[model samples]
Target: MHAQHDIVIVGGGLVGASLAIALENSGLDVAMVEAAPPGALPPVFDERNLSLAEASCHALQALKIWPLLQTASPIRRIHASRVGDFGRVSLDASEVGREAFGHVVIARDFGEALEKRLGDVASLTRYRPARFIDTQGLADGRREVRVADAEGEHRITTRLLVGADGMKSAVRSSLGIDATRHDYGQTLFVSRVRPQRPPDGTAWERLGPHGPTAFLPRFDRHYGVVHGVPSEEADAVAALDEAAWLARLQDAFGWRAGRFVASGERSRYPAVRVVAERLTAPRAVLLGNAAQSIHPIGAQGFNLGLRDALTLVEEITAHGLDDAAMLESYAARRSEDRARTLAFSDGMARASSNEGLAMRGLRSLGMAALANVPGLRAQVVAGGMGYRGDVPAMCRENAQ
Candidate 1:
C-alpha cells in the first residue's frame, strides 16, 4: 500500500511549483515530484533575467509572490524597432498609458523564491529529485506514480496526473502523446555585459546578418546581452575571454550603445519549438513547456507557460479536479492560445532571421507597418499583456 494524493504534479520548476502553490488550500492534496535535489538548489539568477509583462505581474501578484518581487527593477519603457535594411520605428511606454510594459527578475532568484514558497504551503508535499520508474492507470480511474527517491521505490496515486516537466517532459513520454519538435539550428547566447553608460531607460537590439543581438538594461552601468546566432558559431564566441568577448559583441552589435564591456560569463542554448500533440488525456493534463515550447524571439516562452499553469488551475477548480471536463477545458483554451503564440513567435523568428534579401525586405516592411498602425499596435500590446479573454478568477484578478 502507498500514500495517495489528489494530484501528482511532475516537475517543480517555476510554472509547475507555482501551480502547486496556486492550488494550495483549494481543498485538494497536491504532491510535487521534482528532479532536482533538496539541498542542492543553487543560485540560478546569475546568468539571465526574465521580463515579466504587465499581465504577468498582475497574475503573479495573485499568487502572493509578485509583491515581494517588486524590489527587483521594473522596466518602465521598451524601445523596440526593426534594425534591418528598412527604416526603424519605435514605441514608447507613455504612448500606451503605462509606467512600463512589465519588469525583470533574475532567473536564479525567481526559482529560489518559488521553491521557498512551496515549502511554506501547508498542504503541498515535495519529493525532490525523484525519478519516475513506472506510471500506469488503474481500473478505478486512479493513476499511480511509481517514483524512486531516497526512500526507495514508492507509489503516488491520484485522480489526476499533471505533466509540467518542461520542454523535454518525461511524463509526456509515459503518456504516449506524440511531440512535435523543430530544431531552428540557432542558439541563444545569454550573459550580462556592461555598456558605455547605464542604459537610458531602454534596451537596444540590432538585427543583422548573423543574428539579432540585444542589449537589455539591468541597472547602473550593466546590460544583459542576449545574442541569437547560428548554432555553428555560438560556441566559438562563448569561449572568448572578457576583453575579447566585448570586442566580438561590439563588432556584432555596433557602437549604438557607445561601448561594450564584459561583466558576465556567456552561456548558450540551442533554440527550438516543441509541442505536445495533445494537451489532455483521460485523467491527466500538461502545463507549461510540457504542453508547448517555442523560440524565445519575443520572450513568449515563459509568458505562455505562465498562462498554461494559470488556465489549468482555473479549469480544475471550476469543473472539479477529477472531472474529464476540467482537462478538456484546459486543453481547448490553451490549444487556441498555444497555436496562436507559437505560430506568431516561430514565424517571426524565422522570417526575421532569414538571410535572403526578399524576405528581409518583407520583414522590415512588416515591422515598420506594424509600428505605424495604431490598431495593430494595440492588438500586439494586448497580446503581450497576456490577454486571453475571460480568464479565470485567479488570473483575471491578478492581471488587473
Candidate 2:
C-alpha cells in the first residue's frame, strides 16, 4: 500500500499549495494530502483583506500564481493612527518612496487563483477529505503516510514530511510536537461593506481603548473592516443585524475618512496564537499556521505563513529537499523570523487592544515615531514583504 515520492505534505491550505507549486518542475515528486476539498469554496473575499508586501508579490509572481490573482486590489497608501480620547498620529505612504505601503488582497480571490493554478500542476496529487490512518518515519529518514480513501487503506512514503494542516494540525500532533497556545479571548468581526466614501487607496486604523478598528481597501467602493472585542461582547456586537451593526461600528469607529454605513453579511472568529515548540525534526517540518498562528491585529497570521512557505521552498531547492542539513537550516533560518514576528504581532495586540491612558500614550508614540523615522518605516515594509534577510531562492529575482 505504500507509494514512494520525494515529499509528502499534509494539508492543502494556502501555504501548502503554494509550496507544492514552488517545488514543482524540480524533479521532486510531491504528494499532497488534505482533509478537505476545494469544492463549494467561499464566494468573493467576503470580509478578509490581507496586506501583501512587495516581496510577497515577487514570490507569488515567481511562482506564477500572481498572474491568476488579477482581481487583487493594490493598497497605494496606508493611513495609520492611534485614536485616544486626546491625540492621534498618522502615517501616509508619502513617508515611504513606494506608491503604496503594500497591496490588500481578498482571500476568496486569492484562494480561487491558487486553486486554478493548482489544477495545471501535473506533479501534484490531491487527496480531498481523506482520513489519515497513520504515519511512520523510518530511522533511514524516509517517511510513510497511511490514509483511508473510498477504497480503504492507501499509503505513500516520501523523503520529507510536512505539516501545513493549520492551527490544530493533525500532522503536528502525529509528529509529537507540542504547541504553545495563547487565547486572546477576543473575537474578530469581519465583512466587506459599502462605506460612505472611497478609501482613496489608503488603509486606515483607529486605535481606541476597546480595540483597533482597521479598514482595508478592497474593490472600487467597498472596504474590509476587522473589529476586535471580547468574546462575551462579540455575540452582542456581531449579533446585531447588518444595519444595526454598521451603526454600532460607525459610532465606535467615529469618522476619519468621512462616514461608514451599510455592510454585507458579517462574520466573526475568535482570535488566538499557536506556536509550535519545534519547526522540524528529521523528515518532518511545519508550514503555515501549523508552525505559528499569531494575532490578526496586524493582519500577520496568514501573511507570515506565506513567507515561511516561500523560504522553505527556496532552501529545499538550493540544498536538496531530503538533505538533513537543508532541513535543519530551514528550521534555524525561520527561528529568528518567527520569533521576532510573533513577538511584534502579539505585543501589538496586547498593547493596542487594552484600555488605559499609559497604553494609549505608548501606542501613539510608537505610531508617531514610525511615521517620522524613514529608516524604521522601510524596515517595516521589508519585514512585511518577506525580504528582510538572506533572500531565499523563491523570494529572489526570477526564482522558479
Candidate 3:
C-alpha cells in the first residue's frame, strides 16, 4: 500500500522548500523529496547571488523566512549603461517612494535559512537524499510517485504533484512536457570583487559588445560580479589569473564603480531561455526552473520562481488541493505573469548582446528615455523590484 499525501513536491531547493513552508499548518499532508543531503547546499546556490525584490521580501516575511536570513545588502539605486557608448540611465529608489530598490543576498545564505526553517514546520515531511524515479497518473485525479532514498524505495499517492526540480526535471520528463529553449550563445562568469569606491547600496549593469556585466552590492563592501562572455571564449576567459581576470573585467566595464582591488573564486553558467509549453497537466504541475528557465540578465530567475510557489499556495488554499477546476484557475492566473517575465528577460539578453550600430543606438535611446520619463522610470523600478503584474497575495500584503 502506498502512503498518501495532499501534495508531493519533487524538488527541495528554494522554490520547492518555499512551497512546503507556505503550506505549513494548512491541515494538508505534504512531503518534499530532495536529492541532496539535508544540510548540504544545492549546486544552484553554490556561488550565485540573489537580488531579492521587494515583493519577494514581503512573501518571505509572510512565510516567516525573512527573519532567519542575514547578509542582505540593500540596493538604493540602479545605474545602467552601455560600455563605450552614449546611452546611460539611473534609477533611484527614492523616486519610487521606497526605502530601497531591493536587497542582495548570497544564494547559499538563502538555502541555509530555508534549511533552518524546514524542520520547524511540524506538518512538512522531508525525504532528504531522495530521488524521484517515476510517476503514474491515476484515473481519480491523483498520481503515484516513486521516490528512492537511502533506506529503500517508497510509493506516495498525492492529489497534487509539484515539479520544482531544475532544468533536467525528472518529473517533467515523466509527464512529457516539452520546453522551448533558446540559447543566447553566452556564458556568465560570477564572483565577488572589492571595488575601490565600493557600491553604496547601488546595483550597476554595464552592457558591452559581449553581454552585460552586473555589480550587485554584497556584505562587507564587496560587489557580486556577473560578467557575460561569448560561450566560445568561456574557457579562455576562465583560464586567466586573478589579476588578469580583474583587468579584463575593468576593460569591459570601465571605471563606473571603481578600481577592482580584490577577488574570489569564480563560476560560470550558460545563458539560455527555456519555457515549458504547459505548466499544468492532470494532477501534476511544474514550478521554478522546471516551468520556465529564463536568462539571468535581469535577475528574474528566482524572483519569478518564488512567485510561482507563493501563487500556487494561494490557489491550493482557496480551493482544496484536489479541485481540478482550482488547478486550472491556478494555471490561468500564472500565465500572464510568466509570459511577461520570460519575454522581459529574453529581450534584455538579446538587446545587450547585439552590437550593431542601429541596435546600440536604439538601446541607448531607450535607456535615456527611461531615465528621463517619470512614468517609464517608475515602471522599470517597479518591475526591477519584482512588482511585475499580479503576484501572490502575500506580496501585495502591506505592500509599499
Residue-wise C-alpha lDDT for candidate 2, range 99-148, written one tens digit per residue: 66567888888888888888888988777767665676664668878877
> Which structure among the candidates has the greatest TM-score?
3
What range of 10 consecutive residues in model 1 has the weakest lDDT sum?
Answer: 39-48
TM-score for each prediction? 0.94, 0.92, 0.97
> What TM value does model 1 have?
0.94
Q: State which candidate, 1 or 3, has the greater lDDT.
A: 3
Model 2 alpha-carbon drift over 4 Å, by segment: 38-47, 85-89, 396-400
lDDT of 1 by residue, 73-183 (tens): 656655554455675646566788877766667777677677667777999888887876657876477888888888789888888888988888888988888999998
Which one is best on lDDT? Answer: 3
Provide the lDDT at 230 for model 1: 83
Candidate 3 collision pairs: none
Please provide, for model 3 over 1-400, each residue's C-alpha lDDT reduced to its tens digit, 9 standing for 90 to 100: 3788889999988899999999996899999988888668677767788989999988899888999887888989888888756868887888768888779999888888988888799988787888999897685667899988878888998998999998878898899899888988999999999999878898989987677899999987999999999999999999999999999889888888889988899999998887899998788899999999888877888999999988888898898876778778888888878888988888888887787899878888898898788888877777877788777888876786
Off by over 4 Å in 1: 42-46, 388-390, 398-400
lDDT of predicted model 2: 0.75
